[model samples]
Target: MRYSKEHKNQTHARIVKRASVKLRERGAHGIGVADLMKEAGLTHGGFYAHFDSRDALVIEAVTHAMDRSTERWRKLSEETPPEKRLSKIVNSYLAPEHRDNPGQGCAVPALAAEIARESSKTRRVFSGRMEQMIDMLADQYPGLPRKAARKQAMAALATMMGSLVMARVTGNSELSDEILKSGRDAVLERAASSEKKPPRRAATSV
Candidate 1:
């Protein structure tokens, strides 16, 4: 039986949502179209109805994941004061809850490397999404010009992403926890340093 337009849209959303989580839990190439469709509670034959190819689904999935993450960041930051926004973001992202749950966590650390090696179309889409994330973070950083803030955002994100990767892969749980803490602390330090005013020269004694 043929589904209505609304039903088709819902099905398409379900497929993209499931694919988003699966792609993060497993790398970009780790999931196949058949498996994705199956997890989405649909038959493999319907996969082409939503997307032209597995790559198309992947692009949609990555965009969906990153957009969700950015929205979450905005929500979390909104609850905190302006000065503490970046700190709050860093801490929450590196928190144990996020670290232990890679499937629902940020896509940057999960699928970035694999996406890097994918087709140019995928890379361009991923790049654009990632830049949006960076630009969002850049705005939260204070005391810096826009260009400088963008650089700081890049550095902060790099540290957080690398630390998260190590934390996830390390054999010891204690080390994993430490890695998370260090990443949070490091980002907070970076934020603090950026906000520091220049030291003034002391007045000479007569």
Candidate 2:
């Protein structure tokens, strides 16, 4: 049966959305194409109609997941006070809700390791999304220069992602919570300190 163009687009989006959650819940290689198609209520044979290859689907899924996360961060930043924007993002990202819900949380903590081993094209796609995330994070630090803000964002993101990975893997629930708290505190502290320091004046020649 021939599906209309709008219907095909909707079906393709549904498949990609499901794949995004499943990819995060399981590793990149954990689920097969057939299973993903089946979960989307379609046959494996129809996969080719929507995507060129499994790698293509994977790239699209990763991009979709990161886009959702970025939108959430952007909303949080807009709703928060200028002074507290970074803290709001950090706390929300490191919260227990995010840790316990891998399928619905940030892709970096869930798929970074797998993406690192993927093909160059796949890695490039992931890198581009990550750059968008980093730029969004840098915007939270309005007090710093562009270079310094980006550096701070990188460190904050590393801490948040690392803490989340540890929190999810550790057997002790208390330690997991502590890890989240420590990560949030550390990021906020660093941001606060950086904003407090006066900008250095360029050295003048004698």
Candidate 3:
């Protein structure tokens, strides 16, 4: 029996979802169509009906992972108090669990370097998703000007991504935690300093 259009869409979405996580865990090049399809609980033959080509599926998978991560952040942020949002985001993201399981974690840190060498279309999708994530993070600082908020987001994202990469590459767990803490403290301290600026005295005549 033929399934409805909605059923087809759901199946396709499932394929993308599974592929996205696999791509994150094992870089895009590491996974093949058959493996991804099998993981998605679909047959290899049905794959082509869902996507025009492997590239098309890759693009969709990237977007799917991005959306999942963003939704997770939103939920986490909402459940957490404002003051602890930064800590929550940083600590959880940099933890060993997230590092080891990129399949279920943020896409930027997981796949940014890999996606950079992909086609322009892939890069564009990655860029757009990153911008949205940064914007969400910037919104946490309502008091700061747009430029300042963007800068702060840049620091936080860069620190987290860089520290994670270093930690993973060195295969040193203690060093990884240290790197995470140092980066987190640096960004938080800078933000705190900005909040409590030193008072300016009246200029005295020389």
Cα TM-score of candidate 3: 0.89
Relative to the unseen true structure, what is the C-alpha lDDT of residue 79 in candidate 3, on a scale of 0 to 100?
91
TM-score winner:
2
lDDT of 1 at 192: 86
lDDT of 3: 0.81
lDDT of 3 by residue, 1-206 (tens): 79999999999988888888888888878669997888778788988989989889889999988888777778889999998787787777777877667678777777888898889999999899888888877876656779888888888788878877776775657877677677777777877776577545789998
How accurate locally, in lDDT, is each candidate? 0.89, 0.93, 0.81
Q: Against the true structure, what is each candidate's TM-score? A: 0.93, 0.97, 0.89
- Write out the backbone clash pairs for model 2: none
Lowest lDDT 10-residue stretch of candidate 2: 170-179
- Predicted candidate 1 versus true structure: per-residue lDDT over 79-151, tens digit per residue: 9999788888898899888888888999999988899899999999999988999999998976787888899
Error of 3 at 159 (Å): 0.7
Candidate 2 lDDT, tens digit per residue, 81-200? 887888889989999999999999999999999999999999999999999999999999888889999999999999999999999998349999999999999999999899889989
What local lDDT does model 1 show for residue 14? 91
